[model samples]
Target: MAEVLFYHLTESRLEEALPDLLEKCLARGWRVVVQTSDPERRDALDHHLWTYRDDSFLPHGTDADSSGALQPILLTAEGAQDANDPQVRFLVDGAEPAGDLSRYVRAIYMFDGHDPERLAGARRRWTIDKAAGHDLAYWQQSEDRRWVRKG
Candidate 1:
């Protein structure tokens, strides 16, 4: 099952969340593909978190070319399609929750309570009425979060 986890964090929280998120996915034996909008920040993350044997990294806007290393696949919006690698999991940072999210079997969307325009755009683009799948999730720190498997 494909899984996508999206996170919306304050710039201050990114350093904390990134490592924990990466470790969590690694512990679960999931191949990770991360998409970011910033090249420098992505490169920094690649330098710190990427290991030759366990992870891989690519900067946003870089080519889709990949090393055989198990490192997480890193990319930008233009390279997002490269995520076609099978059994892959996605971690999108500072990304709006729109687009063809149905490409993954399981996904998580994090909200930051700002960017009403982007949020509304995502709501319009990705809605339960149009998506197809068994498990769909909406998690807010304030709500009861659970997976909803389609019938």
Candidate 2:
């Protein structure tokens, strides 16, 4: 069974919170795939990952990149994201979870907490993933802006 995490983005932007999470996944030697709803979102994230910080670098490539198979992190759209054989998958910007949960060690669904639609979507996903028997955790911003897992 895959470990599924739902990250409620309230205090931080997706661009701000995502790179650090991706860095942690890389530190664990896990190949990652960041799946977006569309190619435009994928390209935008691809650009942000490269320049998110001046002092840091996250080595990643896109599905469109020739070296997708060799990348530590692969940013892709809804179609055929298995090119990198990712161990971890991050679903962002309203992207739905990839159907084959067993293929991934961990799957993260990140959504904007301030958006009513996103919040409802997360709730719907929670119910589905729970029914599917995934070990689930929901993380939301605390008073101090740290992640606090809630029931």
Candidate 3:
């Protein structure tokens, strides 16, 4: 079964939390696809990954870039599941899976706790994924800024 993880963000914002997650994925030799709901978010994430830290870098590209499959990380507004043939997929900014998600080794949903709509959406996804028989997990940041599995 595919592994599905939900990250409920309360303290750190997306810009602060995502790069660290992506970095861990990279360390494991996993190519990643980050999906957002709009072009603006897609663009913003692409740029953020580049300048997130002066000492570090996450090599990534968007659909506008050439060689989509060659990128270690890809950002997109669409739900193109296999565009980059990534082992890891991230759903950001309320983006949902478009089709079959079993192809991915792991799929992560990052939602803000302050946004009720996003929280509700995460609950819906949790229910659906649980019923679908995927391995599900929930994570929340502790006061020390460490991610602890909640469910």
Candidate 4:
């Protein structure tokens, strides 16, 4: 079973925290897929990954890109079954977990704590994933703006 990590975003928004997390994934030599339910969110994240850091760039391509398999990071909306065979998947902005999650080494659910709907979704996912026997972890942002394991 794949490890499921739920990130409760309280201090930083998705755009703010995602780049650092992506960089960490890259450091581990893992390909990544960042999925959102909305196509616009995927496009916005595509742009953000480019401009998020001035000194470095994250190699990412959207599903519309022809050479998706060659990209280190693939961003797409929901219902994308083949997403570059990434080792990690990031579900942002209330995106549901992809159906074939066992293909991934880890699945991360990044949800905004301030949004009621997102919070409910995350909780539901936590309960579901927990019962499904996947290794589960919960993290919340600390005052110093770092992810701290809460459970």
Candidate 5:
């Protein structure tokens, strides 16, 4: 079964949290696709990733970029995805799960816990995914800013 993980963001914002998660995926030799809610968010994230840290860099490109298939990590908004045939997918900004989950080794949903709509959406997805029989895990950040599995 495909594995699905839910990330509840209460202590940190997306811009502060995403790059670190993407780095972990890269370290595992897994190609990644980060799907945001809209083109603006995707573009914004594209810029953020480039300048997130002075000492570090994430090798990523958007779907519109040349040689998108060659990028280890790809950024795309809703309706565009998997340009590099990634093994892992990250859904942020209220983006929903893919129809065919089996294609991915793992799928993650990261939502802002402080947003009522996002929290409700996460609950909805949790119910749907659980009913669909995909292996699901929940993660929430601890007081020390470390992710701890909640379920």
Candidate 6:
């Protein structure tokens, strides 16, 4: 089974949660692919957080146009459709349509707070309808982390 781990941000700020998430993914040896609606924030993360095996940080958005030590492909939703190369695994962080989740074999749908209705709605639209031959895990963070198998 494909493992999907959703991380629901409890803190109002995303900065507080980023470090832990990055550390966890690195420790697990997972190559992360982040999709965000905010291009500036996404560029910031690409600039600061991501590191290649060469120990060089990836460059910001369009600056990564060239293939080099600093160029990690920062794909938007449209770019993601053509990204069929098996060399990378994705860690999408945005909403459904923005993430272009159909490309991924497995996905973790992360959400904040106590809103099962919202979760259910997403399930009905995405996982139940679009995601076939894939496993999706729904996770929420509150007093502690909890997850349930969705699709």
Best by TM-score: 3
Error of 2 at 125 (Å): 0.8
lDDT of 4 at 95: 91
Off by over 4 Å in 6: 47-93, 97-106, 114-121, 124-126, 129-131, 144-151
For model 2, the stretches where C-alpha displacement exceeds 4 angstroms are: none
Q: Per-residue lDDT tens digits of candidate 2, residues 6-84?
A: 9999998899899989999999999999999999999999999999999999999999989999999999996457778
Q: Write the per-residue lDDT of candidate 1 for residues 33-112, one digit (tens) a residue.
A: 55554666556555555442345442222223454233444443443444435234343444543455555544544334
Poorest 10 consecutive residues by lDDT, candidate 6: 81-90
Q: Where is model 5 more than 4 Å wrong at Cα?
A: none
Clashing pairs in 5: none
Worst ten in a row by lDDT for model 4:
76-85
Report the C-alpha lDDT of model 5 over 1-151, residue by residue, as the tens digit.
Answer: 6799999998999999899999999999999999888888989999999999999999999987877899999888854477798999999999875576768899899999999999999999889888878899999998787899999
Winner on lDDT between 2 and 4 is 2
Model 2 quality (TM-score): 0.95
Candidate 6: Cα lDDT at 125 = 41
Error of 3 at 75 (Å): 0.3
lDDT of 1: 0.44
Please identify model 4 stretches exceeding 4 Å from their true place: none
lDDT of 4 by residue, 1-151 (tens): 8899999999989999999999999999999989888989889999888898789889999997888888899998865545588899999999987585677899999999999999999999998888888899999999778999998
Using Cα atoms with residue i matched to residue i, what is each candidate's TM-score against the true structure?
0.54, 0.95, 0.97, 0.96, 0.96, 0.52
Q: What's model 3's lDDT at 42?
A: 91
lDDT of 4: 0.89
Quick one: RMSD of model 1? 6.5
Better of 1 and 6 by lDDT: 1
Give the TM-score (vs. native) of candidate 4. 0.96
Query: How far is 55's C-alpha from truth in model 2 (Å)?
Result: 1.0
TM-score between candidate 1 and the true structure: 0.54
- lDDT over C-alpha atoms for residue 71 of model 4: 88
